[model samples]
Target: MKVHIHVSLKSGVLDPQGRAIHHALEGLGFAGVNDVRAGRLIELDVDDSVTDAQLDEMCRKLLANMVIENYRIEKVGEKENA
Candidate 1:
């Protein structure tokens, strides 16, 4: 099975990289982009037997910083839930 983990900063947390990208876009004459919140997508190929609990554990323990980041696990071909 293939999984995609989307990791991003929490709502109240500041994102310097996102800000920089926004600024760069404005500099390059692109407008109407009010905000940009950057995030990451991690793709993994795991056995079909991998349980959702194990995937969540992987995010909580190693993939994401529980302090200021949030993550969503997406298993290919299935609808995702928080």
Candidate 2:
């Protein structure tokens, strides 16, 4: 099975890197760029037998830092479907 995880900073958090990128984009003549928020996408190929609970545990344990970021997990194709 395939797992797609998206981890992003919560609202009201400061994102210096995203701000820098937004500035750079405006410099490149990209107008109307209001804001930018950067996040991470993690893809994992695991056994089909892996449960949702297990995947959630994996995200909390290693994939995402629960302190500053929130994580959402999505299960993609199973081995047979793939």
Indicate which candidate wins on lDDT.
1
In candidate 1, what are the lDDT values of residues 1-82, reduced to their tens digit? 7899999999989999999999999999998999999998998888989999999999999999999999999887444423
Instruction: Count clashing residue pairs in model 1.
Output: 0
Q: List the residue pairs that clash in candidate 2.
A: none
The Cα local distance difference test for each model comes to 0.92, 0.89
Candidate 2 vs. true structure, TM-score: 0.89
Give lDDT tens digits, candidate 2, residues 1-82.
Answer: 7788999998888999899999999999999989999999988988988899999999899988898999999877765344
Worst lDDT 10-window in candidate 1: 73-82
